[model samples]
Target: MHRLLVVLCISVALVAGAEQDVLELTDDNFNSVLKQHETTLVMFYAPWCGHCKRLKPEYAKAAELVKGDDPPIALAKVDCTEAGKETCGKFSVSGYPTLKIFRGDSVSQDYSGPREANGIVKYMRAQVGPASRNIKSIDEINKFLDTKDTTIFGFFEDPDVALAKLFVKFADKNREKYRFGHSNDPDVLAKYGETEKIVLFRAPHLANKFEETNVQFEGSSESELSTFVKENFHGLVGHRTQDTIRDFKNPLIVAYYSVDYVKNPKGTNYWRNRVLKVAKEFTNKATFAISAKDDFQHELNEYGYDFVGDKPVILARDEKNLKYALKEEFSVENLRDFVEKLLDGELEPYVKSEPIPENNNAPVKVAVAKNFDEVVINNNKDTLVEFYAPWCGHCKKLAPVFDEVAEKLENEEVDLVKMDATANDVPPEFNVRGFPTLFWLPKNQKDKPVAYNEGREVDDFIKYIAKHATNELNGFDRSGKSKKTEL
Candidate 1:
């Protein structure tokens, strides 16, 4: 019976491993297969990793699509623990499921593109051809210009010159972000300029009353082209979506609203026009953009706000990445005032807090956003506060031990406090890098909070308090013990 059961388990494992759509490679065939294909995307993963498990089905779906393409973009995987450990180490892969694109003669680049099936398929298709497409005539130039994304065209009479080579190199690095094409036709080159000129044409839907529709560049380096494209890609009030948020440079002011281009285009522009009015006044002071409220709801929730009616939400960030919120209702006047104050460094940032507890004098005092100043910052007694995330496993283990210490020192001269770091905003002076971060706020020097890195036992807390407390304790000794009152 034992032999029969072992045989059944082995059979099931073999069946599951054979069903993978992606080709499995080891050190022996890895380089051979990479050299065989024009473009191959490889995922280096381990079987026991949770993230790799979740990505298994998504990768399988993408592999099926890429294998059917004209040039056949090979989707392959290397099991680092099974038979490919040496291959993973050679590539310096330190994480599970690291993706890299291998083009035959070119240097391999990391694949930071999307993870979903359709998005990966689209991204890989873009990599199948040359970095920039070759436009043979005026007809092909007009066809290539018809795209939803901003397009760049380099008109050169000769394709083997230095400028053409530089343009292709830049496009090779940024082709995932924008469209690039080059034309050598005399008819097409005559329209722009006979000289070699790079022209950036803005998207039609991105047109506005502010900023030019197109711009020509005479720069010599790739960095200058990057700067020119970034500065001129979007109009005055940039049409920002979730995918393009990282492109907008700070200090940035973003307007979040119910913007639907297909369902209600007029309403989207109505608010965009209002934001443009304020954007023009602060020109060059900061970058301005608008994002869809529903799409941006998760991030706004971190700022402690919910989706209220159609009234738009306004938020700004400084160069330091400190966030500022607008409290008043959305209006041209209110928005303009908020921008002026934010740029002038006068607006108070929004503080996120839960409702203060009705009675916080328990053994372990609770510190919240509303009472942080009263309980931890401005209090006269020494405070040992724990900033913790509720979902953290380490914090859950320390909860009962912390309660015991607080009860043991109920009559002492210090306060034992805990705050939910997720639900409340911490001050800038204290940095909480991980869960269950503890800090000691000594008396009179309330501004300076010393970080606590001692043990987590009841004795550890008591001893730390005894040595760091500003006022001597009445009920405890230096060794963290109860004082004797025998006479």
Candidate 2:
């Protein structure tokens, strides 16, 4: 009995270890496996990618769920960094954890649905047939609506219609979120009380008794259909990942509130409800999204907002990558005012990575984005500017030397300035590509900023400035003493 118990424990352990039912494919056998499996889902991943690591368990669970289907759907993975580099390259896998579906040797489609076990399984099952189902009877249409959370039905007069084909393509991309079916039957069309050639029906939830809400497309253009679906279907946008955030496009306003939906549901609702009220006011102008503090710390840092503070932070980004933070408290009135200022171009954008100086006492006057045009562009004195990033080690090393150079040239006509390139946007003509990049902007010749390629020592800077300056060097000597002649 003891031996039998030990054997049973070992068998359970083995089964648990074998839970990863996904097939591992190499460059050699990838083509052969694709040839054998009629429908296969391939994931191109890298070991170092965090997203790929998170997707592994979910993909394995999906694999286990669909391993015994009628034609047996196959889930395969290839490590792009290793033996599968060629295979991944052939598929143009630019990003890690790219999923592609293969239907025999002739067809391949990029999978762009939700990255969850159940979502993946549902999408793969849908891909086994045509993107949109053909409903024959009213009972079939009702049954289909009952199964899906959201169902879109296209009632077409004929099977080979243009709108029907467009609806199928749209459904194929969004199968994870919506179910699509088309009916040419007069009985099915009559049940929905539609006479138009193309009509879209949005079936309500099962809890709501599947009440069908629909709209008719008057125009046959794809853009008209797409706009109708986008405007009506996407009720609210919630950003959970970076990919979803990017989908919102530029000129997006995201509310980074501290509320745990799982732990403190009330707090979450209170925060989101406040943002939702403001979101509704400007829905047509900008995309409004709510992001939990923990899930969006990286984005917060990128936009130069603090997520570890007491109050929630609101941030907006334009198409040009310019970021703005709302200084006012989280209220509907304050948010509305903030958005108004943003749209009116009254708000000042700032870079988070730049260091704010304590004072301008040092010889090098710190230039920031706010005063960049005033200090550097409008100044009458010839300016030697050092564009440096705070995190650069080489820039740190040169700080003292730059300060000394600034002191030596203080009495002269030239002004030595330092600007944090990471935080400030220099003029386009400056072209600061690297850290500790120096440029000499002549007094009246502001448009022609000359790049400094000489050594980083004080002597090298002094010589370079003296050589290029329009005025004579008066108060300083090369050996750090008062002189009459040019150093």
Candidate 3:
């Protein structure tokens, strides 16, 4: 089954250019591409997928049919066998030649089985309705404004059977409101058909806006299905997007720079306290939270912001409209005032957030260092050195806890230092594979900073650190007594 998917995917990619509606998805541009269009037809495939290979030609024929002057749909192909693990995982694409249709940024339809062109074409017309215009490229889809009527989106791969199920459910319910379709076609990728799925919509008279309510085709047991919906349904709830974000109409974007540990004596507390006061004042009308110190970039990307070097910039727009966003520099007061200004119809002189405090201007006692030696060294206490990038989300989620742990152990027996791995240098010798890697080194043996713990849990990591610190201070071999069973 996997091999079949791989074969189909590679073949489809080869012919993707022939179909204007169809597209190829990669990690670098998948989100941006989807954001630009309304819907899409995707085929998750791999080079090794034999079933996919067989489906390629059929998919191509479907693409050609859908590219007619009045063709009804578009098609796309996703090569999951490459370095697209993250992209595939995000969409919960588990199998090859998994057919799915994305409406806005979420999956609106999906398909599997019977890899034939006619079968695929029949499915597309049934789901999205007859295409109003012929389109051959994603660029053309971008140029084409969507109609006001029903639209169909499709994707296919063998492992995406569950995704197909969700699409089928939505299609059944909204048959008149919209047409959702898919197929695991062999021989070609339905590029033009896929592209049509995105730009076409039900005409306003025919469009049932009332039926556009939240119809969650989801459950706890169907995580993969939900993920597919989240990534493809740009307007779905729990998955933030320009349209979905409108759900938080009177929302507040909180921007905080303090690490949990450095929040207090570091005088970052002044701002922290002030933010709480501001948060309370606008509690009913706004929603906000502190950003992860490490996840600055991810935050920016998630919210579709440009830069995050400045302290957290609170960005608020109509929860229903992300396009009309308001961003302000540090301080909850400034942010509140900006929101007031927006509400008041004064849209000029918006304040930009302050850039990160650098060098002598830094608020924290630990200054940003360029190299290992520049990292502060302590002898009496164990040292916890964290190597992190400024863009990681998981790292951001763990920031507060990391800070708290350091603050609790401060001055007594441990030194906590943070290093910018991307900006400075992280040697391969350290075996660091991912971001926010925590290295624990005994104060006595400063040169060898071994990998301590990874992942997001704060309490578990703190306990592990304390245990190692105790051993180091008691004149015991810090690396002694292997925990692993000896052969």
Best by TM-score: 1
Query: Where does candidate 2 stray beyond 4 Å?
Result: 1-21, 26-36, 44-73, 79-129, 135-153, 160-180, 185-188, 197-216, 229-233, 236-241, 247-251, 257-274, 302-313, 317-355, 358-371, 374-487
CA lDDT of each prediction against the hidden true structure: 0.82, 0.74, 0.52
Write down the TM-score of every candidate.
0.69, 0.59, 0.27
Q: Model 2, 320-382: lDDT tens per residue?
A: 657888887878889989988887789988555434466776788888866776678887889
Show the lowest summed lDDT stretch of 10 residues, model 2: 203-212
In model 1, state the lDDT of residue 15.
45
1-487: candidate 3 lDDT, tens digit per residue? 9999999998777676554555677888776777665545678888798998887777877777677533335577778878566778887888786887776557886664235665565556655543222334455543442432234444444424655555555556544323343434432125433311122233222222222422233332345443434332322111122222333334444443543322442344344445555655554465544444353555454445555553555554444333233454566567668666655556542222222235532211242333344444544556777777789987787677777766655534666766666554343345667887877777777668788755456556555665677444222234422234348
Off by over 4 Å in 3: 1-92, 95-371, 376-381, 454-458, 470-487
**lDDT string, candidate 1, 365-402, tens digits:** 99888798898887778889999999999999999999
The best candidate in terms of lDDT: 1
| Structure candidate 2, residue pairs in collision | none
RMSD for each model, in Å, please?
8.7, 8.6, 22.9
Ranking by lDDT: 1, 2, 3
Model 2: how far residue 238 lies from native, Å: 5.5
